[model samples]
Each structure stands twice: as C-alpha cells, then as structure tokens.
Target: MPIHSFLNYLALEKKYSQHTITAYLKDLNSFQEFCNNEFDKQRIIEANYAQIRSWIVALVNANISNRTINRKISSLKSFYKFLQKTKEIDSNPLAKHKALKVPKQVQVPFSEKEIRNAINLLDEEVDFESLRNRLIIELFYTTGMRRSELINLKLTNLDFANETVKVLGKRNKERYIPLLKPVQNSLKKYIEVRNEMNTNETYLFLTKKGKKIYNTLVYRVINNYFSSVSSKVKKSPHILRHSFATHLLNEGADLNSVKELLGHSSLASTQVYTHSSMGKLKEIYNQAHPRSKKN
Candidate 1:
C-alpha cells in the first residue's frame, strides 16, 4: 500500500515519535481489515465513504470506546489527506464524517503528603539504580517536565551557579525551572554515581551500562513507585506533575505561573488545576454550612 510510503513520510519528514507512528499504523490497518471483511476490498487506496462508514458502524456495534473510535476516524482523515497529496485518490472521504466524542474527566491530583511519602520511600542505602530512580521522581515533580522532555535532558542542561535547569520543551522551545537545594543535592549525587559507570558524555540519565533511559523503563519505575505509595489514587508520572501544579495553586500560586511551569501550550490546559482548587473550596463550604449536613 502507498500508506507505507506516507508512514515513512511521517517518520522522516514529520519527525513524529515512534509511538504516534505505531498508533496511526494500527488505525490504518484496522480500516484495511474492515474493508476486507465488510466490502471485500483489499487496498486502502481504493476505499470510499461507503466502506469507511461501515467501519464506523462496526466500531459502534463492537462497543469500542468513544476515544478509540474517534482516534481511528481522525487517522482515516489523515490517511485520505496523505493519499490525496500523492494523487493516490482524488478527495478525502473520511473528512466530512463527524468524529465520536467523549467528555474529559477531571482527574484527582495527589496531595502534598502523598508526594512526600513517595519520595521518602526511596531508600538512600540502596545502590545507584535505586538512587537514580528516586532522583528521577524527585526532579520530575520538582520541574513538572513532560516525560519526553525529562528523558531527553542532557548533562549540559544543568546550570548549578544559576540554580536552574534549562529544559527543551515541545516544538523545540526551552524553559527553565529553578534548582532547589534538595533537588540540586540529589542531582549531584546521581551525577556522581552516573559517572562511575561506563561514561557517556551526552545523555544525563542512564542505565548501569551507560545506555540512555527509555520510556518503558521510566514508566515501570513510576508505576512501581505509585503502587508502593497510595492505592487510593490513579498514578502516572503525569499525576505527579498534576499534583505539583495543584499543590502550587493550593499554596496561592497564580494560574499563569503554573501554566508556564507546566509548559502547557494554553491557559485552558493549566486551568484544570484551578478546578481542583475549587473542589477543595467546595469541600470546605459544605463542611462549614449548618444546612449542608446530610442524614
């Protein structure tokens, strides 16, 4: 299929992450299957709205999630657009279809106490890997960087004299977060241990063999940490970041400040933590009001 060439274009020209490319492929392949099973068509290039709409009906009948189905539809739109650009087909068939919609749930953020407990669980007596994982957790919460930004951080990014670490955020933008004393000390210790292993001059964090840390390893460390800390809350590295912004908001930090700290592209993205703060206010209001008591 010419879809393969378009996918290669996405990887090379578009510079999308492998994860995104894989997702696009999965959606395209699913559509290909739908065509074969429903319309008896083998080529994605030959598909039209009649076949694609049938795929949507199949998705609904199969009870797939609104989010998943929406993403698949969006993928089809992109695929058709790619085909159109290459003259593989004339018009984008999936463009006019309305995507499935889902409401965005407001996720609960962890409390400051939970953050403290999780960090303390990192035993200093353990080996370098243990300490490195602890420091990764610490820096992530402290800096509120996205996982990709954190993983891609280089040794040269740290500026000790100025007490700030410059992070290259999404779209090649850079931002600086302050280097707190505790974080500075933890970073120093990690760097000391990191240097003792096989030396790599570029990447900041690494395995014992001096390989760069990958997303799976980072996610595993975060998952294990979350499991040990509190089962009451949903946990991901992003949850820690949400906790960071919420804690700051609760402590009187302004929305714009939190927005910049979080590297959110828009104020709306950062405004969700304001909702968290409002929930706290509602709890206090309900507790104090005499008529608010329930039997």
Candidate 2:
C-alpha cells in the first residue's frame, strides 16, 4: 500500500520515466517478499537495518552481483527516504548504510573506423526498415541519447528547420541536440517511407506493422549491426552512446559541452567518458611532445 503511494510520488511528482519506476517497484517488491518470507514482517515500511542487511546477505548468497545488490539497496534507500519525508516513518532505515563496493568497469568504445565501416555497410537503396535502422545508429552515435529517449521520440521532436532534436532525458528533462546534415538527409529519406505507411502513430520509428518500437528491437538493431563491425563482447545501444562521448572527447571537445550534449545532470557523470579517451590523449601526447617521442 505504502509502496503504491511511493510509486505514485515517483511517477507524478518526481516525473521518473516508466522504465525507472518499474525498476524501483521491482527492487522494493523483492525486498518486501524477502521480509515476509524470512522475517515474518508484513510491511517493508516497518523493516529495520538488520532485516535489510539480512536481505543483502540473501542476495549475496544467491550469487547476485554487488552492483545489482547495491541498486536494489538504492531503491530501498529512495523509498525509505520518501516515507520519512512524508511522515509515514519516524527514521530512515538505510540512513547510515554504505553502498557495496562495485568494481569499476572499463567500457571500450568502438573505434571511429569501426563505426564508419558499420555505416558503410548500410544499403544505398532506400527501404523503410533499412533507412530507419541506419537513422537509429546515426542518431545514437551523433546525439548520445539513451535508448529510451530515442524510443519515446515523437515526430514533433524533430526540428528540421533548426537542425535540432528535442530529447526528453531522465527525470523528464528536455534538451536539444543539433542534427548533422548527413543525419538530417537520412531522416528525410526515412520520413518519405514512413509517410507511405498511412498510420497515424506519432512515434518516429515503427515496426513493419506500424507499431511503436520496443527496447529489445532497438537493442537487436544495434547489436546485429555492430556485431559485424566490432568484436566487442558487448554490443548494445549504450555502446554507441559511449562511442559518441568518447569520440567527441577524443577530438578535443570540452567536458562541459559534452556534458550538456549528453544531457548529464552533473559533470561527474560525464567524466566517465574521459577514461575511454585516455588512449587518444596518450597517442597525441607521444606524437606532439618531443622528449616523449625521443624517449
């Protein structure tokens, strides 16, 4: 019951995307079920730190990764914080809790040559699906939008006149991304085919049946194409996004500008891309610095 109210708060007041709201609800429900089965507790709001710790132990025993367990804990933290703020709870259970140590992962982005090869593989002949998929890949690499943002894109969001796209980012924040001429040309070609479908769906990308696209389909599109170009174990839409930021930074783009382009709420979030750009920086330094080159 309290969880329902908290979810409503997340949806209505916090304006969290549905995907995020679902993750929060899922994490909370898992904890709730754990409390009921293990501790005979009927309500999560009544749970304390010890009970929460027991759930963490159970998750660890079940072989769940620390990163995943930490995310579940974060969901609980936000829920309990909301409960406290609304006077439903006297004190927060996770007030003094520390997040589990997660090993930092180095995400290797696709090289520019790899990305270019993948784009070149696209058929020159214009077909609806082909054009749409090409546009999808181009948009991800160029704009650095989250997959969800691309999926939820409406036709109205495309500002052809200004060569910009209005993306609705996390927490319903809006940011405009400038579209390159090639991407704009691709969009024009895709639109010509899209209009022939005669469906009134406002969403920009659609399936063969003119239905709005889903996450799996988008992931499949990116994975299928990138599989041919790169041998990376993980190929997904986010990789293209990572490539977008990495490549931009590799070309001397400033951190703050990349931060705004990526629609990051803070500079810290944008700093992760710098790690991927380090190799480029090292190469440049070695080439330009005479002492380093001599050594």
Candidate 3:
C-alpha cells in the first residue's frame, strides 16, 4: 500500500527515528479508519479536504487537544506531500490547510538545588540499579540528550580519554557532547557493576535481564528519584533537559552554544529555554547597569 511506501520513505530517505515513524504510521492509520467509517472510503489516498476537515471536527468533539489534533493533521499532510512527490497524486489535499491553534506552554524546570538534592540522595547508594539510575539522571542533566538517544547509546559511544560521548540525535544526526567529571565517575562505577552481568548487550544502559532499556522504564527512573526532591507537577527526562539548558543559560552560557550542545536544528527551537533565564538576566542587569544607586 501507499502507506507502507510512505513509511519506507520516512525510514530510508527521511531518516526519521523508529519512534517518530511509528507515530506517523499511527496517525495515518487513524485517518484511514475514520475515512472508512464516515465516508465509506476505503482508500485514504483518495480522500478530499472535506473528509479530512470532518476528521478534525470529530477529533475536536472527542475532546482531543488542539495540539494533538494538529499533529494528526500534520501526519496526513505529510502523506499527501509524499504522494505528490511520487506522482501518485496530482494535487495535495492539505496544502491549503491551516493548523489548529495550540496554547503556548512554558515547562517549569527543576531547580538546581532540587537536582543536587536528588543526586546527593543517590550518591549514598552502592547497588547496580542505583548506580545506573544515578548515571541516567546525571547524563540527562549534563548532556541534555533525549531519552531515545540515551537508551540507544552504545559502548563505542563513550570516549573517556576525550571526555565526550557520541549521541545519535533526531533524523540520525550525530553530535558529540563533552562529559563532566561527575558523569564520568558515575559511568565508570556503573560499568564496573554492569560487567558482572556478563551480558553481550552493546547498549550502554540495560535492564537487570541484560536487555536494552525501554521508554517508560527510563521515565520511571527519572520520576521516582525526583519525586523526593521536587514538587513540580512534571518530573521527566525532558524536564531535566530543560533544566540543563536553563541552568547553563542562567550561568551566562551563550544561546548559540547551548543550541549546538542540545542538538537543536534552529535557534527558534532553542529559544524556549530562554524564558526561564530572564530572572537571571534581570539580576545581572540590576547589578551591572549604571542606573540607580538608591536614587
């Protein structure tokens, strides 16, 4: 089917991650199902804009958020674009479509003190899981990598001599992030315990059963540890990454450098973290500016 072809294009030509490709496939299949049920249309490739609009309206009535609905539409848009590229379709159905409005959300990052408290708590533990979990937190906070990048990290990705770790980021982009002393120490200890398992897994982080770590398991590791030290509503890997970027920016790191370090494709994507650094900027401005001296 054209759906399978489009998926192959995303995988082989576009070089999208498997996780992302799966999301796209799910969105496409959902649209196809909607077409079958509502319009008696078996083929989504033959669907018109009106049917697609009805799908959006249905999603809205079902209480799906605007952001999520937009994402589903975006998947269909890409599918039509792919069909156009391959000459299977002469016109794009979603070319004139405008995305639904989504509210801007500013994610609150963990305070530096909370991060340090969590780390200090883990520092007292001597077990394999504890050591691995500590390294997971440190890696997330220090390297600012996505959960997938950390889970996919292989043994050869580490370069202790150069103090850098090779990360395979989105769209199969590879970038090297320097490792801090604390993370290095944690890695050494974790690997020492990891060696006792005698598993042939090449991935850096693994389960007690010698298998690669899954997404929810990684989230649990972050959530369970931070629950003690943070009262924030969200405690996940992305928050740690946000905290990493915010803390660096707060300490006077350049925006462009942080962008490169975080593997952002554009400055616009990196600018979201700048909102959290405004307080630090205000403090610095008040201290350094030649304005008021008790005027």
Pairs of residues at least 3 apart in sequence or in different chains that clash in candidate 2: none
- Give one digit per residue, the lDDT tens place, for model 3 in 1-295: 9999999999997668899999999999999989889887669999999988999999999999999999999999999999999999999999999999998988999999999998998888999889989999999999999999999999899999999999999999999999999789999999999999979999999998889998999999999989999999999999999999999999999999999999999999999999999999999988888884456
What TM-score would every model get versus the actual structure? 0.74, 0.70, 0.71
Candidate 2: stretches off by over 4 Å? 1-99, 293-295
Candidate 3 global TM-score: 0.71
On a 0 to 100 scale, what is the lDDT of residue 185 in model 2? 94
Task: Tell how far residue 203 is off in model 2, in angstroms.
Answer: 1.5
- How many clashing pairs in candidate 1? 0
Arrange candidates, best TM-score first: 1, 3, 2
In model 1, where do residues sit more than 4 Å from their true spots? 1-47, 61-63, 71-92, 95-98, 232-234, 283-295
Question: Which residue pairs in candidate 1 collide?
Answer: none
Task: Report the Cα lDDT for candidate 3.
Answer: 0.94
Ranking by lDDT: 3, 2, 1
- TM-score winner between 1 and 3, please give it: 1
Question: Global lDDT of each model?
Answer: 0.84, 0.93, 0.94
